[model samples]
Target: MNQIVTFGEVIMRLSPERNKKFIQSNRLEFYFGGTEVNVGISIANFGGEVKHISCISDDFVGDTAISYLRKFGVDTSSTVRSKLPLGIYFLEVGAVMRPNSISYNRSHSSFSEIKPEMVDWNASLKNCKWFHWTGITPALCEGGYHTLKEGLVLAKKKGIEVSADPTYRSGLWKYGADPKETLSDLLNYSTIFIGGVNEMNEVLGSDYGDSNEDFIEAGKLLLKKFPSIKKIFDKIRTPINASWHKIRSRMWNGDEFRETTDFDITHIVDRIGTGDAYAAGLIYGLLNFDDFKAMEFGAAASALKHTYEGDVNFSSVNEVMNILEGNTSGRFNR
Candidate 1:
């Protein structure tokens, strides 16, 4: 198996219990997840050799977090335990008419305060075939951004493939750095860029509108700027209500543009970590199948994730492959 390494923050996701709104709930349900780490867990569930790198408080809470990663078969040897606090986010699940909302309380998190010395990138990535990260890391804090940047540079030096989810989180980018500049610099070392057309304007300084043609043009502009990018990964999402979503995925692999079949995802169990699941599935497909098949697998994998209750997709390879083969009825096996 190809060893994969994902570096970023892992948070305690506190959502209102029993699908209650934030104001109506008295108790919150907690789950462990983060963008890059979620990707690691999803890949691990599919029998991949993956490692999650993050910083957590040096206490029982941090140890528990590491334990969960280990339970999912994700190697935690590179995780750092520090004296800082753990990052957290409050999620409010949405209903038929209303939309979902999130409030972040991750300021001063151990991962946010991660220093360059805390991560031994060379040792951690020595045998890594793929190194992964997200734009959310750079948006967190200067220290986190630098730490990720150093790792990415080292990955390039070691000839390891690099991938990123250029996710645009306006709420998290409250730091001093400009997202456009930060993403441009970090994406220079990336081989695969995962995000939508809107990110082009939000983080890449492009002036394209929402049309499919505009998206394609904007993608071309992006490829021109970042010569290292060999593939562009993205998906289309349609709102059927707060609880239902219609999704489809697409990719451009330098010479070819491909799209997957539309997937109608109804009755979402948990609204978080869909992007990470998609990214993980795409990476798996890219490594094991053709470019177009990879897109289809990624889309199907993420659609199945909506039925799960947590941030990580525990769906197996057989499950995802079955969905790709038009077995999405969720029927029982005899």
Candidate 2:
């Protein structure tokens, strides 16, 4: 079977010790992560054959980053190495009422300097069954955007399914074009889209109502606008505090709405990469299960992610199924 391919930047994550604020902490833990990389890790954990494409500095940090991915079962044979330094981000894990904070030190990093000319679209995507990327990629540089677009076109030509998450971080798109236009341009090639209802209204001039009914209406309009889009998925979060939250996922498959069981998360280990976990689960489910099952599988995976601290969701498929099968009792295994 061909592998599922992902393209993006992988940064070195620096976080204070668990539950410690940055200003008060004297120690930091290092981990390599990025949106696409996180998703690739989850998919790989589930025994999916996955490959990631990106550039890192030709240094010890870059070598460690690639090895970190290899440890998680992701193929990094296509990774590029340049003279630039690796991107870095500082994360401060928060407690009740205090939110998590991220400070990026990633400007002009090796990954940001990568151009379309640096990658071979056909060779990278060859024999790939699915191609994945996010809004974060194009935000890096003009060459990044062109490279992503080229990859999308090449994937389509290769008959590969395309999945995308419109992460929609406004600050990332400061390279001179409106995020709306840029996102729409890339998303036009997507078969499965993961984004929010309000994002639709804010990004495009679409007036999908603000309420539940509005979301359904907006979903319909989105399908109409992008005929190739087969499934639209998003989740709703009911935060009880910084540590606990109620979450569930919903999807519009052009035919009907598919909803998942409501999930209550009483503890959150690290919320940073939970969205990517959800996306990975959804993508994995879509490849293996029906739409109804896929929705719940994704939500269950996210619920399990809340119990672990890291950029990757270490939860196994059995664990996710255990949660989804109504086995919420966190019992010990004999």
Candidate 3:
């Protein structure tokens, strides 16, 4: 059994050529990505025993996804295969003054239609110490919602620590009930919560501005509302351009506030899925180190994600430790 288990959908991402819109691109790049799956891949790359639990289509695309995850040493024995088609999305990477856009075509995907009995919860998470999920799972469909609830219940009963990322996607939840009600119900079972202020406001029905003060107040209010939650990890971002960004993060760990300095990244190969990488890094640090060290490790991991092309972070544990030790000189190998 692995130490970590993550559950979510896996989709094949098709992104347009550089500096081109979806309509103008003659060819697109293909990669397999999902929030939870990305986190699992990152953890596995850092030598963590990670298992991914999700439904995949019994097709070539599904096989490709499984292979991609296995390349990073992730365990996929608990994954199920169904007859439904795999989900896909088209991404348009922004340039200059433009912003990136994603158009998903994933209705009735095998993972979205997953039910409670489809997964062997007891065996899959028997020796797991940490179980992870995201808001997108419950927003998939009513069946997905029940399945996620069942997984959470089983994980709690088995004494596994659970973490959740409230990555609220408005379009994904259109087929189901309101995101607010659904996410609130799930948060009750979550031990660690990760999201931005905008997402928190959307899911928790709060009308707050985007300022440091607002976020601190919101964090205090949220902790009071959700007593089971022990920590809130917030990723802060500042866009310098389409190809550059400045990133930092802060954590509200029940008793004290901790933050890391901004990391200025000059080249961004792919901006998508960095948040998931940060979450995975934070989870690793929290499991192994103290609170302050965890925040620095997580921020450094997120900074490293900008240099990679795909969504899954490919940096090693040594690289992350070096960055956490304040070696940002970027010296090449001797």
Name the best candidate (by lDDT).
1
Report the error of model 2 at residue 1, Å: 4.4
Q: How many backbone overlaps does candidate 2 show?
A: 0
Residue pairs in collision within model 3: none
lDDT of 1 by residue, 145-248 (tens): 99999999988888888988888888788878988889889998998988888876765676787667777777788888889988888977888898889878
**Model 1: per-residue Cα lDDT at residue 73:** 85
lDDT of 3 at 237: 88
Give the winner by lDDT: 1 or 3: 1
Residue lDDT tens for model 3, 109-196? 8787788888888888887999989988888888778888888988878767899898887788867487888888888888898876
Model 2: residues with Cα > 4 Å off, grouped in runs: 207-210
Q: Please give the lDDT score at residue 316 for candidate 1.
A: 94
In candidate 2, how many Å is residue 243 off? 0.4
Clashing pairs in 1: none
| Candidate 2 residue lDDT tens string, 1-334 | 3698999999989998988987888899988899999999999998899999998899999989999999988988888998999999999988889899888877688988888888887778776998888889988777789889989988877778999887877777767977778878887888988877866665567767546677778888888877778888887777999999887899887778767768998888888888888889989999999887888888888888888888889988998999988999888878
Residue 210 Cα positional deviation in candidate 3, in Å, after optimal superposition: 2.7
Write down the worst ten-residue block by lDDT for model 3: 195-204
